[model samples]
Target: MKKIILLLTATLLSTGVFAQVKTPQPSPTSKIEQVIGLTDVTVSYSRPSMRERTVFGSLVPFGKLWRTGANENTKITFSDDVKINGSDLKKGTYAIFTKPTKENWEVIFYSDVNNWGTPQKWDDAKVALKTTAKVGTLPMKVETFTIMFSDFKMDSAKLNFIWESTEAMLDIEVPSKKIAEESIQKTLAGPTANDYYQAAVFYKETGKIDMAKEYIDKAVTMRKEPAFWYHRQQSLIYAEMGNKEKAIEAAKKSLELAEKAGNADYVKMNKDSLKEWGS
Candidate 1:
């Protein structure tokens, strides 16, 4: 009797160890992190494949609140405040729920981020943002559930949900103009060495030779260890100013630095410029 009990315990332990072996999941998890303008957007969800079965109205019923993905609810996070479907949405992570219909889809962003399947006790108080997106028919059937961004601009894009033959879209907008203007103001107020160098390059291209020379001189002085590229810019500025002596001097300095750095491209560029300038 003692031997039998020991054998039974060993068999149960072996079965538990074998069960720990991993296998392919029916629905796989996916994560996406994307940056739009100055904002960071992240999405986490599970993708379920269609095994030659109808999805929209059959596998997933119409006019019912869906968790938006298999297992845990789909999550979307925003680093900054944004607009969804022209409605204000604060910055944070939210559980995305959906209600599909033939004409339009109701997209809900719920404050509750932890839940399994549908919220058993649905709470309207937990709702953060709710909007509607028009449903469209796709040309071809999609075998797996997909969420993607499209029609991207500097400040805005469209989030698309696709499954089977239906597509739902939501417009997302960020404050790109405010961020850009603030960045420009901050840069112009207290410019860095690289900023001065970029301004010099811009001025040189725009036929402002005097400003180019001034900014380049400031860049050379401000930098702790100026690179070969900076000397190359100085050489170009001097050459454009019709100062052949200074151009030759700057080109020689650039060639020496490039050779020390083992940068074959810059070496060739300096050699070509020196030959052109008779340095």
Candidate 2:
């Protein structure tokens, strides 16, 4: 009987099914993410509730380094290089620590991303970027700590930190103008067959007949199997260049290809142009 009881206890322990206890946390973790132009910014932190306790100068002292969050170190990540408080900050995750005062808040971005609460020993060498932001007071009391993005634009946004009745903001800027200009230049310089064909149509409509002919010829040469629309545009370009013979010939080819490809619209277009040209 003793051996059987011991065997049953061992089997129950091996299976490892046990009851779990649920408890509420005083401070809860949260993740906030936002896209400012082409840059991705993510913040991970813990939010401690007011619980009717004084925060700014009492529980969280003034003129001293604070964890900026509860439990683990508050962290901020940047997907691309960004400008913070008018200074360049490279792309990486950093621990956020702050010193609050009545006038302004001193924000520090530390290189050491992994730490608990506050650093055991503060290291000036690990500081990546440091900046100051003016503190503002909220009209109503806030129950929970929150970080938010506001006042967004094409290349910039404001990162706001709110706890209790105090709020602080940091300006973040991304390289939008330079990226957009480079992309436009690259796409314009590498025109595809469709691009050339479209340009030809535009130039032909705008009365640049010589430039229209150049683009249409280039489009035809670049296409392995020119579509019915390409041939129709080519015929229109030839007609605008005062070459009626070549215009009629190109229209006939367009009509044949359109009919074979089952494009009724292009077929009708080519037929109308051909008839007008006395083909």
Candidate 3:
């Protein structure tokens, strides 16, 4: 009787303890958002804290496809056409995946991002660009996902997606000034790029003669746009050249562009300069 009673007591204790216990859940993953100049990029992935005993060849095998990150597949998107490793990749979003090896890793870009694993056939990866990176000697490990642009410049950057002991990089370039000029010609000259006209007035209005001249050229290259900005630029040039009458003529045109652009400051400044020249 006592044995039966004891057994019943033990069973109740066990049930109570079991009922009170709760399993631990993984922490929420992090989201990375970044912009490389005109290119807006975002990377979303999950990560768990891992240890020497818990990761690498044991947890993640050698020479196998890693989702590049945990949970959802890693993804990257570009707002414009960019060069990845000197290879032109059109504007699109892609999944960043990789194949691990003993000494190096095979980086991959997949056209299909929603899929969970790397299917044997890679026809779906339309614009795949392959690159390799070797393991670091210090046994570096990354617990969370990361993405960044290294070697950033006014017009270019090196996009690096790094984790664990491996990394992959791709070069990216923005539209250059020449390209902007060509764009003007191709579209058969508009008041768009590389034009000096209204843009010069805008620059003068904004207190940036240098930038104004730069962009005005872009606009002039566009053609059929307001020539007043160009004439205004010419006026400024004449003023600098000590040609008072020519300067006055150019200022009048500049006034026209600024007025059209609703730029009050340029009109005031040019009016003052013309008065000084007359005096």
Q: Considering every candidate listed, which one attains the maximal lDDT? A: 1
Instruction: For each of the candidates, give the backbone clash count.
Output: 0, 0, 18
Model 2 C-alpha lDDT per residue in residues 5-115, reported as the tens digit of each score? 999999888677543445788898999888888788999999998899999988889999899989999999998889999999999999999999878899999999788
Count of backbone collisions within predicted model 2:
0
Ranking by lDDT: 1, 2, 3
Clashing pairs in 2: none
> TM per model?
0.64, 0.63, 0.49
Residues 1-279 of candidate 3 have per-residue lDDT tens digits of 999999999999999999999875462466667666656666666654554344556566878878776667677787777766566767778877777666776777777777655544567436466666444433666664456667877668776656555455666776554565777796784444444455666666777766765665555556666655465566675565477886887688778788888888888877887788893
lDDT of 3: 0.66
Worst 10 residues of 2 by lDDT: 14-23
Candidate 1 residues 187-233, lDDT tens each? 78798889889999999999999999999989988889968899899
Which candidate gets the maximum TM-score versus the true structure? 1
Candidate 1 lDDT (Cα, whole model)?
0.92
Candidate 3 segments exceeding 4 Å error:
1-27, 52-54, 117-127, 133-141, 164-170, 173-279
